[model samples]
Target chain A: MKRILSIMGFVFAMGSITSLLIIGMDALTFERILANEQALFQSKVLDAFDVPYTTATINEVFIQNVEAIELDVNGETVTVYRDPKTGRISMEISGGGVWGPIIGVLTLEPDFVTIANVAILQQEETPGLGGRITEPAYLAKYIGVVFNPDVVVTKNIPSADNEVDAITGATGTSTRFQIILNDTHAKLFPLLQALEN
Target chain B: MNRFWKRLQYTKWFNISKDGIFKENPIVVAVLGICSALAVTNRVENAIAMGLAVMFVVTASSLVVSAIRNFIPSRVRMITYMVIISSFVILVQMFLEAFFPVIAASLGAYLGLIVTNCIVMGRAEAFAVKNPLKYTFFDGVANSLGYMWILIAVAFFREILAFGTLLNFRVMPDTWVNWTVMALAPGGFFVLALIIWGVREWAKYFDVAAE
Candidate 1:
């Protein structure tokens, strides 16, 4: 009994100390991490709305042009950014990619059916292959695109209202990304309509 | 007395440092931490960031593991080391996310995976647990340096071929066709293999010349 107690005590002591260290570290960086996340989210939102912002002026632009809100949809609380002037809304959205979740901000046009723009906030795809999804050249195709009916990503040249030229080497990411786009848009369009009404 | 001091510092500490950096380089020779070496070596900026992150994790974990060596039970020692190493890795991830979000994003899952990096665990088990704090510190620095240089070199060649750029600055001419394979997994494999071969050849020649 004494031997078991000693072992248990050792385990508890070690576990608690490790937990405290992690907690202390997390507490120290919590605020800064939150700010960084906010900055990245705002930058993506601005990009999606096609608002011009430099490193020095992004926060100002976001504050001036965007009103932010948090809402629950399908048991997930998502932050959405609205451009009060344009009535276009940007939402934090994510879906699975090849290795992990691909996270991004999506902004819709004033009509709420067409995509104004999109900018990828985070991804874990192959660095030089699927990772091109985050590159500007690929994302540029999303600007002012109409995604209603069905959004498509294809390897061939995009020639339709919902067509986007897939990244040359990243077919998997493009296909999965299309799925995410269609799903998120389908899920949110009605909720957005309810909010507008 | 001075000769003895020279042998202790130079023949000992200097050799340890040199071995880690060149002779028994962690990446090329030991080949212990190959996962991050390949994963993050696609870009020079990412390689540097990863190297620095590993250096911090290995050094901090080694320090703590060494400090607690005497008290930890032999059976639970591995688990304890893991806990220490992971704590440092999480701390690094948090710091990078807070201060260097660009790097944090680019690195992504690999940053959190640093806890699994064998270099930290290997050093703890082989050196830090048995050595005094000073020597353990030296060992940590040496191994990280070994790991850093190899990663940087791999990134250098890969970036130049893959993107025709180094550090994202255009270096290749407009007419240059980027070798598509150079930016992918095959490129990493090919480049790392070439490096290992080149290092072995150089060492062989150096040894022959000395003889």
Candidate 2:
């Protein structure tokens, strides 16, 4: 019993010291990590506006061209990025992938009906397969697509304005992405509409 | 103390350190921790990042574990080493996320998996627990370099064949077509096998010449 207690004490002390060290590391890097996440999201938002910014200039350009405001969409608070000149609105989206979470940012044209651009901010879709959803080639296909009936992912070649090609060998992820993109759009579009009126 | 330090530098310890890089290399010769070796070697940059992360964890964990060797109970020693190693892995993860966000993203779950890497646990159990701190430090360095060199070699061929690039910079002509399999898991296996064969043969020939 005494030996066990000593072993337990040693283990506890070691764990505590490790936790404290990790806490110190976390505290040191917390701000930079937060800034990095914000910068990534902001850049994706800016991509919708077709605005270019390097890592060094992301904040400056975000300040120059984007107005970020929070809105209550249903019971949830959503961040909305507005382009003052074009009246474009950008919103973030998140949903489940086959293996992990998928996140993206999308922007509507000034009219709020036409998609200006959609960029994936983060995703865990299979790389070279489902992961291609974030590829510029794939994301670019969504540009000029209409969101009225929600964007459709087609395995066949996309011809109609609302349809886009599905990633080859990743039909499940493609279909899941379609649902996430549409559902997020449906959920937020009405709330975004409330902002206009 | 001075004689011991001098002997530590110039004697059998030197060969022990050298052994990890070639004769008992963790990756090619001994083949410990092959999962990450196969997973991250598709890209040269990812391999470099993983190598560095492993080096940090192994070196730091070994040092701490060796320093505290006497205090740990024999039955709970594995658990203690794990805790120490994981703490370092978390530190590396946080540091990467803070400073090198892009690489961290590409590395994904593999970074966290460093805690389970056999090379680290093997060294902590087989070496660090019994060795002095100074020798344990050298062992960590040697073993990490052994692991790193093999990972880099596999990554080099895999990247060049799979993407026609090195570190994402295109070296092949614009008309060059890539081999997709090289970007996947099987390619890593084939590359690893060939490297092991080549390294073994070379080492064998060198040994025979010396004898």
Alpha-carbon RMSD, each predicted model: 4.2, 4.2
Q: State every prediction's TM-score relative to the real structure.
A: 0.84, 0.89
lDDT tens string, model 1, A118-191? Answer: 88877889877898888887787887678767689988888888888888888899999999998888888878
Per-candidate fnat, comma-separated: 0.69, 0.86
Best model number under TM-score: 2
Runs of candidate 2 exceeding 4 Å displacement: A154-160, A168-172, B1-10, B168-170, B173-175, B205-211
lDDT by residue (tens digit), candidate 2, B21-110:
888899777779998999999999999999999999999999999999999999899999999999999999999999999999888889
Q: What is the lDDT for A20 in model 2?
A: 100
DockQ of each: 0.65, 0.77
| Local lDDT at B201 for model 2 | 88
lDDT for each residue of candidate 1 in B99-153, tens digit (9 for 90 to 100): 8888998788899999999999999998889887887888899999889988899
User: Which candidate ranks first by DockQ, i.e. highest?
Assistant: 2
TM-score of chain B of 2: 0.90
